[model samples]
Target: MATKTWKIEKDLCRCCHGEGAFNNLAEPRTFLDKVEVYSDMLRECLDIDIPPVPGELCAITYTICNACIARLRDACNFKKQVQDCEQRFMTLYYKNAIQGLKPATKVKEEIEVSIEHAQSDTDADIVLKKEDEDDDDDNHFLGGDDDDGMSDDDLPIKPPKQSVSTMKTRPKPKPKPKAPPVVKKLKPPPKPKKAEPKPAKEKKGEEKEEFTLTVGADGKERFTCKACGKSFNLKPLFTQHYRHVHLKLRPKLRSCHLCNEKVLPWLRPFHMEECHGLPAPSCGACGRKFAFPGQVARHQKFFHMGESAHSCEPCDLKFKSRSEYNHHLIKHGDVKAYKCELCDKMYKWKRGLRMHMLVHNNIRRHVCHVCQEAFFQQSSLKYHQMKKHPETV
Candidate 1:
């Protein structure tokens, strides 16, 4: 059985800037010492990418303590709640205050004018009623002459004249002035002229030809460039060839700045985020950052704890994880299964054969940033760049 070993350098915690609170390895002297030990064991995940290479040690994984993890969680939760509240408030204000006052809903000026006119009409009616009551009281006081010689049957009768104050006439509506009719000038009819002949568009060489492709008996897709007329089986190779050689443009596939991985220019950020250890999940048991949570869980269960649920029948090797056990099962009859299609070459592992096939296809996927040199294998390019260009490294 092959045993994998890892060495973690003794460094101060990134959060507390001190070694774990536990002073003795045998036992904890105080409650704070135990808490410190727990803090050292528990770690929060970061958003970084870990290297795919096995046995590669990363130093940045175990910097944060568990105490800081709790604080960070509480802070993030509070921030999210505040943001949600603010968003709800803004939505309500827009619906009730801003959107309600839009011209499409109600006219502010017309409402104000109508309210003012209604107040004036009400005030005028009240003033006229008070004047009419005052005039009636005055007439009754002057006509009460019963003590002199006037009898009830000999009183002089007079016709009542229409008083302006007594009669309540409605205000006449002012007539709206007629607007002047718009005089639209008639445009003269366009003069008929002889039609000029349209020039024929010249066909471009690139657009004129169609891509010619053929399928082999092996059921592999093959493509031929229309511009250069070069035949290729692999789509990636053909695309790279068409872009650089035929189109006279640089290939869109960019090499990773840190590693020899090649990816599209647009996908560079995503590839770097997942491949490099920027902010990746770290294992609580061992300070190893992984690309995913499942990876860290597997590492904690298998490496640090050594708790295996399954064991191989033939080899008697125990595995805590399902993927590791399945991989071990494949090694029981690990014959040379992978074979090269172009040449009489066979490899025990599929990855080895896949790397070997790149040579036959003549696909140089890895490119060095310093010298702009390309290589068929990533390992070769990595070693070449490191050795040849030590200054860049």
Candidate 2:
């Protein structure tokens, strides 16, 4: 079925109307949809484009011809005679200022920190090697190829043993009677296994959440916002309140006051160009003056060149310092990230999480020396022992 539609007005379709304003004979050809019919109407009349009315279908009935358009251009600014005259006499003089277009260029800033921490791992490696050597010595005598090359010819051979016939000759005279076979009475093969139905599995209980230790004192903590006089009851509340109130001031607040406008205090240290302004420390590596002397040296070492001194031997990744190297190791994804998915306990490894879960569940494994009572994690065990058996550390 074709979608139903109506025209704008009778006067708009004067060409199709004869007896009636909306002639049934002049009705638009039906299509599956109205979009195609509307498109045809738009192309039939070209006044730039057919204007549309809200909540109604459109019917194009007007068009601009090339001849009429040429007449309008003749009566307007675009005149061919005026253009020919200007071309023949060069009426408009060209200026040198109008430079042609060119490709654009951009400069990108890049700061890289090259850290090296591979050396600290050497001591542990040496200790592990020594431990392996000791274990090898105890388990197997791994002698050199020189000792292994010795053949049986290197050892003295022993003579063949003589038979002890004199003492047991009496028993050999008569062969002992053969013992009867202790045959097992035949039993029918077990009833062709009535497919031992698998025992239904019982799922373990769901894990619990970790115990969060709140650090507020006296069940209340006073927090004063630096920007305004807002005080919050809890630290978390204070943090949220601070962010809400002082978010705008954070960019303005990090400055140490001693340095003036020369120092932007943002990531980039802007220098105050005045000579009378206080002196700024220049970075040793890049010779860039920062607002602060210590900050300048740190930036020079860490951003300009090889700043990391410690690194992992296994993966040549570097760190700015020992602490940074330790933090970087977390990215390798091998060691324990220390997060207890079950109870929200953090550990360096899965094993640590397991141990921590046992603690939360109060799985006592260690025994006290004095009271003989067991406790969970070693720390608790030690604490119990100290309380009960003080001397048995």
Candidate 3:
């Protein structure tokens, strides 16, 4: 057997900073410690994308591909690289938020009034010219009849005063088009002097509030890490990050019931029932419950167990049960598997990555698909819905 040598940088792991990791040493004698250790290592170290929240501890994997990892540690500044990526992320996020703004486009009431006035003035000029021509013709026909009827100076001079209704109903004239004045070409502004590009250097770790990532023998990586003194395997993570997200692997559970042994959810169901006081699962489709663990086995044999009725048409995926089918389909679309090797920021799906992108890009476009809430990830969308509007589900 090739003995694997393990070294956790003493600077990396510490019991303090109030962080702990669970270990699934090759064979854990106690199930309680076994479950915690396995979950912690996977969540915290091997896949440090998502770290534990206030009351939680992240999962860490006890596997690392030695050759690939050694290659990684050798090639680049792991800490600086992940941190720089995060800062760039926040900057980009701010820019997106700036872009999502709507501009105002409106025609002013003053412009409307000016157009109406111009039309009316043109119409008045045409009417006045016609009236003056009629008067001139009358003067020509009644020439030199001053003494026979009345002196020309004394002749009745009646002014045609328009009535209130006539003035109000008068048709306005078409306004003349004025030539648009030539537009002055704007002068180009002076170009800004280009600043010299600064040489890349690792940031002083103390300057910002930092999230730490601790790497282990297993290929998986995690945060909230202390140097693991215990010698462990250096197996690289074969677990696909997208498919096996951390919390999903943990039982959909409340506080654990067993004291002596932590509930090993990953353990074969039959083994759980035999070894621990696990309640036999009743079929949701048919309310028929079972007594030992052998019931599902018998049902599979008798019922349409071999034939899969539950299936997704899009992916041509089928499952024995509906729940299995649903869970499988969730994996088909763009899923979030983003883990910040920087701050231990973990998103449930790609949108989570996008939202993280927004935090860097400063994009906040993730409005609520449901109510007053908006989120960066689908998991967040689901969480808000569950918490605020449970009935909506």
Candidate 4:
């Protein structure tokens, strides 16, 4: 007996039946919901209604495609433009009709006669008023009495005016001259004090030896460090310990030719190319280029020399490249360096972390051309197309 496999069905657009991109109609506060609420707008503009599915109720998956939404927006905008033009035209027509009105025949003659008489009276009154003002001004200047017989002594007395030559103007005072600045001789700086010499202390013993070699009971040569009093079985280990701990010596660093920045000998080429825009080094054997000198050397060793330099001792597995060896070592170690900030999920590789981040964002960038189905990744899209539309492949 064969086991039955179950599959989930995808939601299709009600109008187009294509599932590339869509907006859920059942969701509230969404674009499709607003279109449903104002269904008459579509009818008045485009003369169309919402497409309905027989024997099925609109659910969360029931949606309208982007194409239909765009058409609806264009129709609504056109309808609004036509309405605005009609309103503007009617307003201008009424204003012109009021402004173009004609006066009554009986009022026209009376209005013209009244305007002419008013203009002639205003001109005569202006001339007489100017003559009267001139006569009053002349009488005032000649010291003539008023018609009321008021004497000049009883009127307000005015201050006497002075002639230009008769007026006394005070002269401005002159500014006092400034004195020259005084200069004093500065005293010479005092001499610096001489420091007293400190007495030298006596040495305890002749300088301590760095290391000493001895023969152990097991017949193995032992290397001992006199400074730290530590022993090592191997000479290489003893030398490395003395150099690192006692001497405090680090690896020799090289400066970049372009930037003058000091870096480790192994990292100098990479630093120069990445930061200073220099070309990467190429493999002399195969003429293949790489971002760093180390990669070129590794490539030469692995491909040209056919050597497997990296190996796992526990699993006894060997890999031709450093990257493959590192990847194989991940199974043995429980180290997770990459982590997702959204859900606090950890992954062994950066690619795994990036792929997991898509779940939090929920963005579908890859779409199947045959079925118009959308997916978050290209691999998923390929799988969907292969299963649903094999003929298209």
Scored by TM-score, the top model is: 4
Q: Predictions ranked by TM-score, top down? A: 4, 1, 2, 3
By lDDT, the best candidate is 4
TM-score of model 3 vs. true structure:
0.19
Name model 4 segments beyond 4 Å from true. 1-300, 314-324
Q: Candidate 4's C-alpha lDDT?
A: 0.62
lDDT of 4 by residue, 115-145 (tens): 2112244555565677678768976776557
Each prediction's RMSD to truth? 21.2, 46.9, 30.2, 35.8
RMSD to the native, candidate 1? 21.2
TM per model?
Answer: 0.24, 0.21, 0.19, 0.24
lDDT to native, each model: 0.57, 0.47, 0.45, 0.62
Across 266-321, the per-residue lDDT of candidate 2 in tens digits comes to 43224323432323446546667655445654565567765757868779876667
Residue 141 lDDT in model 3?
85
lDDT of 1 at 302: 71
* Segments of candidate 1 deviating more than 4 angstroms: 1-305, 312-317, 329-334
Worst 10 residues of 2 by lDDT: 206-215
Count residue pairs with overlapping backbones in model 2: 16
lDDT by residue (tens digit), candidate 3, 1-393 = 899975442221122221133222211122322211222233334443222222211113332333433333333346557779888888776444323434544433333234654336566667777777987998788767555787677768787787553353455576777556555565565565455655777542221222233443331334331222222222122122211342134244222322244444444333435764443444445656454224544454446455567878888866767788866776776554678664677766655554575456433444554565555455766777888889887
- lDDT winner between candidates 1 and 3: 1
